[model samples]
Target: MPSIMQRLNLRPIVLAPMAGGPGTPELAAAVSHAGGLGSLGAAYLTPAQILEAGAAVRRLTRGPFAVNLFAPQPSVQPTELEVEQATAELAPFHSDLGLPPPALTTQADIDFGAQLDAVLELRPAVLSFTFGRLTARQMEALRERGILVIGTATGLEEARQLEADGVDATVVQGGAAGGHRGGWLEDELADTLALTRAAAGSVRTPLIAAGGLMTAGDVRAVLEAGASLAQCGTAFLRATEAGTSAPYRAALAAAKAGDTVLTRAFSGRTARGLRNAVTEGIGQPLPYPFQNALTRPMRAAGAAAGRADVLSLWAGEGVAQGQEGSAAQILDGLWP
Candidate 1:
């Protein structure tokens, strides 16, 4: 079988999917057209939206691209007491943002099976997932349809597991990675360089290094250490094509290397973003989709008002390296 890079004919760069907003069809196509594997972070999109986004990318680029989703995990519905506590905690922020109280009745209906079916129908060059792994049947189905399956990992064990489970490639997400940490089985954090080196030594499958990689040197180091490609998210946040909101883009531009922290305040899941009032105040959040849903209104308001403090300003530790330009320009600068 061809290697993942060979199959996609991609360069040593992959656009890490930034779900929620930053990942857009135009951004994906621009990067793919520039020879890297651009990815759609379809984790937050409905099945119909996923198909539409794939079509939109197809219309822009004939080059190979990938669509990423969060593997379906069992939903954790907050109890009344839990909901009350979370609501009370967020009430002040809601008031500050001039938003109404969150409706706890709204459940996160993320149908992974339906999303997968849509992906099969769209037939993008690659199908990648994080948060968790897919079942054997799902993997077989993807393989039968000729879709390359890529899994995300944060440690050697996870990489080994993905390889054993028959993933075509594994993105070794280091501690510096922005957004959610893909360490589903373990909580211990490992730096990107260390994790990539360790996973490369252990797993035969191609390793794609992710996390604080922001420059050509960063990409070269990972490739030398054995990564087949470098997957970058924060490095492209300032790219003109990214759908990053105005405030989030400003935060990325002004952010220093250590301004980000991994907090569950915004989404219940441990995701890294800029340190702000919301992150500093909240301690124990409800749970993944529940916490994510609870804070949606405030985040939306923050975005609309360009309030950086209340928004989930997701970015990696290498955010300082982010530059403003078209996606193609950013890719050229990173590789050149």
Candidate 2:
């Protein structure tokens, strides 16, 4: 049988599955139709929504696309004091937005098992996960169905771990990649080329390099460095088919490449993005789900009201290099 990459029929360009909003079904299908693998950032979606999204993508293109989800994370059992502090920290943002005081909920995290069940049923061509690796049983299920598994890694140790766990491929996410950092092993900050070279040397699994990849030349350099393919997120934030908010798109356009800063202010996990008031204001947040949920309403209001300061405008170090075009056009220009 042909390899998974061969089955993908790709153009060495894979969409980076920009969760939160930018990775829309329209964008995914457009990239797939253009001969590159497209991905749905389904981490935040419920099981029903995941199925609906899969159906929507199927309707748009017969080509295969990947569905991405966050691996199951340890539920943060925050102390009452921690919850109080988090709510207090977000209260000002809520007040400014004319919203109710931020409240802590028992159900802040997505149910990964339920989400996995949904993915099994949806059964896209590929399944990619980040933040951690799946269990043996979970990996077995995906393999049994012939769904290629791609796990994210930020360094060599994690890459080896993913291979040991039986992933079909590994996404070597450089520190400069946008959005949440996927490094579970000691907050990896290696450069993309360095990490890719290290993993390519150490692991037998195919490597996908992600981070600050904006042009065909950038992709080529990574490929030469031994990456099998290049995955890009920041480059596609402005694609016409993307669901990026107006304020977020504006921020990306206005940003210099150096404007992005790493902060856990919005999501309670370290992620690189455009610096704003919220990130600067909130220091030492609760954990992932708690912080992500607490700030959701404020972030939603910010996006609605066109306030970039209150929103999480995730981007990479290549902010200045992002292009404005349709997804197809972007893919063509990136790899053609």
Candidate 3:
């Protein structure tokens, strides 16, 4: 089989899949149409939603694109005491937003098996995952269908493991990356360039560098460091076709240096984003899915009402460099 790079026939840029509303089919298709490998973040989407989204992207462009999901994690639930404490902490924020007390355990996890089945049916050019590696059987199924698989890594060890697991490519997500930190291994997070170089030297897999990549220079630097492609998220947050809300777009435009910080307040996972009331207020979040569910109502309300304070404004360290434009324009700017 030809490699993922050959199958994609892509430019040097890959669009980082911005889940939780920012990543739209139109945005993904637009980037793909512009010669970059666009991505739809399908972590929270139901199987039907994923199929509909994949069809929507197909309607927009014939270019190759990727659909991404968070690898399945073992089921865990917050204790009743943890839920009560978290709810109590979130009470004021809810009241301020004219909402009821946060329902800490109301949200249920998406069924990953169904999600995978939907992806196999959609048969996109690429399937990528983060948080953890896929089971060997899952990997074999993707390979059987001629679908390329990519896994996320935050350090050399993760990259090595992803290669060993038979991923077609590994996205080396450094510390400067936006959204959820995808590294599940114990190794420390390295900068994009450093990790890319280290992984390039250690593994045979093709590398896609992600993190703090705002301009063409950043993309070029990562490629020079041994990445075959550079993936960008924050740089496209303001892309015209993205589903990023009005308040979020405003927050991105107004963000200053040091405004973005890694916080677990929103999703219980350590993710990079702009500092706001939620980040400043929450002491400790329960954990992924639990914290993610606990804040869903507030975030949805904040998004609906154009309030930036309560929403998860996930961004990277390069928030200052994000510019407004079409997805094509954004990709053009990032491609050297």
Lowest-lDDT window of 10 residues in candidate 2? Answer: 1-10
Each candidate structure's count of clashing pairs: 0, 0, 0
How many residue pairs in model 3 have overlapping backbones? 0
Task: Name every residue pair that clashes in candidate 2.
Answer: none
Q: Give candidates' CA RMSD values in order.
A: 1.2, 1.3, 1.3
lDDT of 3 by residue, 185-267 (tens): 77375788888888889998999999999998898898898888888999999999999999999999999988988898998
Q: lDDT of candidate 2 vs native?
A: 0.90
Per-residue CA lDDT of candidate 1, range 1-336, in tens? 337778785577899998999999999999999999999999998899999999999999999999999998777777888888888898889888777876666666688899999999998989999998899999999999999999999888888889999999999998888999986888567888888888888989988999999989999999888898899999889888999998888788889878999999998999999999999988867998889888888888888889999999888988888899999999987787
Candidate 3: segments with Cα more than 4 A from true spot:
none
Deviation (Å) of 247 in candidate 2: 0.9
Question: How many angstroms is residue 12 displaced in model 2 relative to the true structure, after the best TM-score fit?
Answer: 0.9
TM-score of 1: 0.97
Q: Quote each prediction's TM-score.
A: 0.97, 0.98, 0.97
The order by descending lDDT is 2, 3, 1
Name model 1 segments beyond 4 Å from true.
none
Task: Compare the candidates by lDDT and give the number of the best one.
Answer: 2
Poorest lDDT segment (10 consecutive residues) of candidate 1: 1-10
